[model samples]
Target: MAKAKNDSLFSLIKSLTQTEKRHFRLYVKRSGNTQDVKFIKLFDAMDGMKNYDDKEILKKVPSIKKIQLSNQKAHLYRQILSSLRQYHISQNIDIQLRENLDHAKVLYNKGFYKQALKMLDKTKVLARDTKHFTIALEVMEFEKQIESQYITRSIENRAEILTNEVLDTTDIIKSSHQLSNLTLNLYSLFLKKGYAKNPQEFEEVNTYFQSHLPKVNFDNLTFYEQLYYYQAHVWFNKIVQNFPNVYKHSLAWVKLFQSNPEMIIKQPVHYIKGYRNLLGSLFQLQYYSKFCEVLAEVEALSQDKKVIQNLNTEVLVFQFLYISKINKHFMEGSFDEGVEIIPELTAKLEKYQYKIDPERVLMMYYKIASLYFGSGNYRKAIFYLNQIIFYQDVKLREDIHCFARILNLIAHFEDGQDYHLEYQIKSTFQFIGKMNQQQAVQKEIINFLRITGKITPDQLRDEFIKLYNRLQPLSEDIYERRPFFYLDILSYLESKIKSIPVKLVVQEKFDGLK
Candidate 1:
């Protein structure tokens, strides 16, 4: 029985395209279901529903008995899957390979050993070419079965050949798996700790990566194994804040796919991830020209129906496009341009809210807040930062959460909310302490903001200058620069002292970069 919270069937139905739904309806009708079919009626009712309510479904689809609703929903769900399978048989490589394997089995049962072996050979080639090792192994097993049962002239020394092939393929698959596991661990370390803020954290991640990294001959590795190797290196560099190495390895990862375009077609998800990491490295390096070139290529690939047909890939397309698009503005300090796209970006964020990860959603909120802050709209910035500060979830990205609170405090101060400035400072200080994020930059910001209200207006400029001088060196400190990466406190203070907008100060800095 489906639980009240488990509306997976309804969610799946809601995710279907109009073409898929129409195909499903035609599939049912072609199978001799009448116009008043129970499942069809239920499908129509559920399709039109704004939410999944079992009582509402039963009320609308009177043909379904109350006692049998669960069974009928389950049946419809399986039927939809069946229809999708048939529809995608020609388009999906895994499905086609499996279907071919099933046909080979039929031939074997009908005493056609030669035909079955031939089919297995062809299917094994497809599976191996696509790096579908498990299917390839299964096809090899089928071949071994036929070789034992009946030996044909073409099957001479076939057992020896199959034995060697299986051994080599298994070794490659194991190596790939190990590298992939290392990559995942490195990524987890990155997500939890975020760029190794301290020397100890850096040493920990570096030790783990170096110890677990497989010492394989890169020249002899298969494409998939090599891909994972480069990916592992990319994550290692990213975690240690080695942007140059990140660019080198991530560019290699992207080029591997570009050189093997067929793999891009077969593994669009990996291809998308490669581009994402590449763009991230390029953005960090501020290589705007190359970034724009790659961004355009990704946008073009995303529009190709063949590249983004799967639901997960569809959501990934949006994720990569929006993140890279907004990041371009961030890199150039084009806050006004970033603000212009917030409406569309927010709508897409809400539309794909379920499909996107919460971490990404939170990051977007931070980016939006930063955009507002850069444009001097401190109230709007605080509004978005509050979304992150008040997020009531256990799995929130702790780094973003901590930084959002810091940015919120700065925004309140910049907005001149003097009435509650002391209280905000106290709350932010306590929150940072609770999170155990009392680093040099965090402590300095808290100390400065905590006493802002006590200083008279005549002494405000001197205090701002004093705090700026104290923080300028810390902002340049290799280990203390992480918070400033998110919020440019020095520029804000300089703007306050110079009696100019922070935007102008940021623009002047950006021009110096050019």
Candidate 2:
């Protein structure tokens, strides 16, 4: 396994954009801070290096000894974050609300209860408007604190009003948390093995979901309550392979945001994620035309200055823009055209690599590998599959690793490396055996490969037909259908049985969906 990286200050500095770096410099010099000199030197030195090298920093800056270097780096790290926090307050609503709360606390500490309450009142409005119920509840608590200790005389029946508001907001927060927690669990289940693998797992998921799902009046739910409700449904349906319900809930999730359009700027990441899931459901349902329309919407979102509010939002928008467009090509089976994007997406991924999470990077490699495989470029398919197969984090996504290895084996076979086939088959089988999740699809494929050498060349078509017949029944079995989704093994089999290109077989299916 690759050792975990731990260059906190260097990593943060490397993640900063040029504009952010410039803002940090301006923020530090705003008060003409004299003590900021050495940290600035440290920050500049670390930023200039391609990698974190503290000894080299000491060589470059004689003002710092080895013992103090750690402290200087730590100080610089904090200063960068503080500068970023100040810089992005205007761009991020949560940050702005938080700053307002901090200011209100300062005022309250100075015994200016009225001013603090006033600041919190404004903060409350924005928080509630943006569906930040948790923040709004905090503001309410602070308001109650002030009103309880001193009669502010701010409004009539202040205690009764605060009590009622606090109770109502508390209920809303509780409901939202229950729903969001369910969503988190469902999503974690999906990430673990992609989908429910068998009858037992499906039953367990269904029981867990139905038991944990909180009852709420759909019409009366707060924006966040409604959002989490829909999000939870999306994950549960997706895990159970119910694409139609996935489409239903994902569209509802996106529509909830659209109904609250002003919140889009306040919660760009949520907005972007809603649309991303919508596109995902459309792709799974093979709603190609609708998928294209949603893809265009997200592409436009990626460019919207108002919604691409900050670096985080910018990264998510770009990520989904590429994902939805890639899925668009995928639904169309336009593999060659899709491969055209590999170069540009590659460069952009490298640029935004630090900002992007590792799971997404691994997923991108799998998508790229699938594109190559669909394009009849098995060598390139294997190349990308190797990245996932040898990915350092095996525990991250066990199913994807297994599928990638299976695809790698098939790619080698398709590339006519029969001499390497037996070893590949054995190794892949062992890998699957070691895994906790399994599908009959994998077993059948491995079993077929193990017998391939024993079958005569002329009997290959018959063997392919037999294998297809076996997998076709499993296609109707929900627990056994995962490999169909991940590997598209059925289409490959159909292509082989019919002696046609895989893309053509897939495009024919796409045309029918249209």
Candidate 3:
């Protein structure tokens, strides 16, 4: 009896075919025994039932048939029963459909796009026949996205190939639109990597772009225009350094700027850049007169206070002052005639003094002294000269030497007795001597005294030659370049000391010439 029951159980398990499986699922669900068979559990059981062949169990018991009959109460149960009965007739069909769909998804994820498409082609045909429009549309979108990725990858590969080859600017010009996007990307890449491998190409990239850029429509450019404009300016600046001759057309730049202030101002700072270059070119050409003419026009156009303030803060103000000062110094003018302009200038300096850098402020002091000295306003010259000497660093020995001469002249000038020339002379010499013992600035005091009329030219010349001869080698070691300034004074003193009419005093360590 035990052996017979075991055989019966095994047979029943084998005979659970698709139809019997569906009947079993329905019976399990509604049989108040909602415990053993959930939907997934029953579905999995039906999946295995595709391979089951249990003829003996079907012949042995009517229990499975009884369960199937119990499931005929509702329309859904009837439909389920009928579908399962049909599934039993063709056991392997659902398994093949599921395997095919699973294979399609794996191919899609692995980027085997063609194979995935082939699988999807069959899937879509089946889905359409079954009227699954939503699922079909999803597959269509996935395919479209893949096609877009293919096009993007093709374009990227073409760009990489072009980068490896020689780039002809002429070809780029002809195919500007197609090449424009790729060229812009290449430019950014080259800039990032320091472009050491292709330095020359990188340098000329902007020149090519600038020449071609104007022809390229601004609105049509896909790049951020601001970056393009910055590139143009950077290129032009370098060009100006190498070939500033292009800036000879100051009038053209001025005219362009005048006609379209808004546009020129907005034009990437590159368009108006040639003006500064033009200023430099004018200086080099010694077109001082024309330089003055051009600069006046630029200054007039840039008269807005905000613009002037920006220029000053950028350190370009020093450049402006330099050009103006050079032009004023060389352009024809009476020494005293320029003195009347000082008060107006003093007000300007006061206005901008807080904004000025220390180096420029010292330059301003130097300029003021030069103007005063040229006009023979010795007191004012002495005042500004003192300011410069006090403020400047001691390492600037050349300027200090010149300042000493100025002090000597001021000490000798009419109404100049109030200032202490000797004290200043001693102080300057002491400071320089401490730093460099070989320097002989103190030995020149006799010539300064002659300039002040405290000694005759003959006395000064004798003293100076004596001091120079004794200190000449020492001066040479201290001063790397030329030694001795005041050539005119040196010449005159030489003449006086050697004159037949004058009897020079030569001091000796004796009561009389031994």
Candidate 4:
């Protein structure tokens, strides 16, 4: 029985496109019952629902009893999957390979050994062509089983050639296995402790990565093996704040596909992921020229039918494209102009709300709020910040939540809402205390904001300079640098001391980097 969660049948139905739903209707109707079939009625009820409500489903589909709902839902789930598989067999190589293998199995079972061997050979060639080594190995194993048991001897010394082929394939699979494991663990480390917070953390990550990294000859690796190798290096460098190595490896990852354009079509996700990492590394390095170069490619990808045809790829391309676009604004310090993207970003967020994760939504809100705040649009900034500040699941990205509160306090203070300022500052302090997010940076900002009201107008410039000087050293302190990435308070302080917009100060710095 299909378990009844909000996700089970309801999510699958919601995930279907109009075309898929239409195909499903025709698929189910072929049974001759049309919409009256039990599962078909259930699917229709679920599809029409805005939310998953099993009780409401019973009301709409009166023919289905509570006792049989689970079984019927399970049947519909399998039927939908089968229909999709049949619909997309041409696009999905794995499905095609597996179907061919199944045909070979039927031939083998019917005692047509020579025919089965011929089919297996063709399927193996297709699998290898697609870099589906695991499937190729399975085909080889089936071939071995038939040749050993049936004595077909279809080709001379076939056993020797077959053994060597399987051995070579296994070696390549092992390289992929090792490199993928390293990459996954490195990513997991980043998720647990973002960007090695201190020297000790950096050393720990470096040691762990070096210990696990396999020593493989780059010239000898298969494409997937090389891709994972570069990915692992990119993750390790990113976590340790080694932007130069990140740029190198992520570029290699991108070029790996550029040199093998066919792989780009087969592995669109990895291709886009390479570009994503490349853009990130370039952004961190403030390599504006390179970032723009890659951003153009990303724009092209957003329009490429081959890249965005699959639903998953479309979601990823949508996300990576917008993120790159927003970062371009950030790099130029054109936050006022950046706000122009808010409507489109907001609509896209709503479009993929269920498909996107909470962490992604939280970051988008933070980035939007940061843009508004930087542009001197305090009320709009606070509006977006409140999205992250009051996000129900604070535990999801606590750092974003913490930083959102800090920015909210600044936004309120800047907006001249002194009536609300004291309360918000108090709230922020308590929130930080609870989250244990206190660093020199946070403490300095809190104390400065707490006392800003008492400073006389003439003394404010000196105080701003004092705050900037005090916080400037912390930016070089690896442990204390984190808060800056979220808020860039030092730049804001410099803008205040100079009586200029934050964007000018940031743009000057960006120009220096170039």
Tell me the tens digit of each residue's lDDT in model 3 across 1-514: 2333333332343434455656655655664664443332333442444233334333333343435422322333344445444444333333334445668779868978677767765765654443333444445455455555654342345444433321332232244433435445544543332112123644565455455554555454322233343344333433323224334343344444455454443331333344564665565444556677777755654554333433232345443544355335423323354566667666766555545555555545655655565455667866776766666564443434344444444434433562565565556556545644222434454334435546654575566566445544543341311223211233223434565211121111111322
RMSD of each: 2.4, 2.5, 32.6, 3.0
Which regions in candidate 4 have their CA more than 4 angstroms from the true location?
1-7, 29-36, 392-395, 417-437, 477-479, 508-514
**Each prediction's Cα lDDT score?**
0.86, 0.86, 0.45, 0.88
* Candidate with better lDDT, 1 vs 4: 4
Model 4 clash count equals 0
Q: Which candidate is the best by TM-score?
A: 1
Model 3 spans > 4 angstroms off: 1-154, 158-288, 304-315, 322-331, 395-415, 430-514
User: Candidate 1 — what's its lDDT?
Assistant: 0.86
Q: Would you estimate the TM-scores of all the predictions? A: 0.94, 0.93, 0.36, 0.91
> Model 2: which residue pairs collide?
none
Tens-digit per-residue lDDT, 1-514, candidate 4: 1333346678788889898999988887787867568888898888888877778999999999999998999999999999999887877799999999999999999999999999999999999988899999999999999988988979999999999999999998888998999999998777645777667888899899999888899898888899999999999998888889999999999999999998888889999999999998888777899899999989988889887767788888888788888888888998988999899999988778767877878888888888998889999999999988878977676778888999999899889998999899999999888877787888998899889888888998998899999999999886788887788898899899989999999999888977
Tens-place lDDT per residue, model 2, 1-514, is 0111368777788778899999998988886875648988887788888866767899888898899998987888898999999878777788999999999999999999999999999999989877788999999999988998998899998889889888988999999999999999999988886788877888999999999999888989988888889989999999899999998888888887888887777777878888888888888777878888888787777788988876788888778788777777777789999999999998999778768987888888889999999999999999999999888888788878999989998999899999999989988888888886557888889999888889898999999999999999998887787787777888899999899999898899988866
* Clashes per candidate (backbone, < 3 Å): 0, 0, 1, 0
Lowest lDDT 10-mer window, candidate 3?
Answer: 501-510
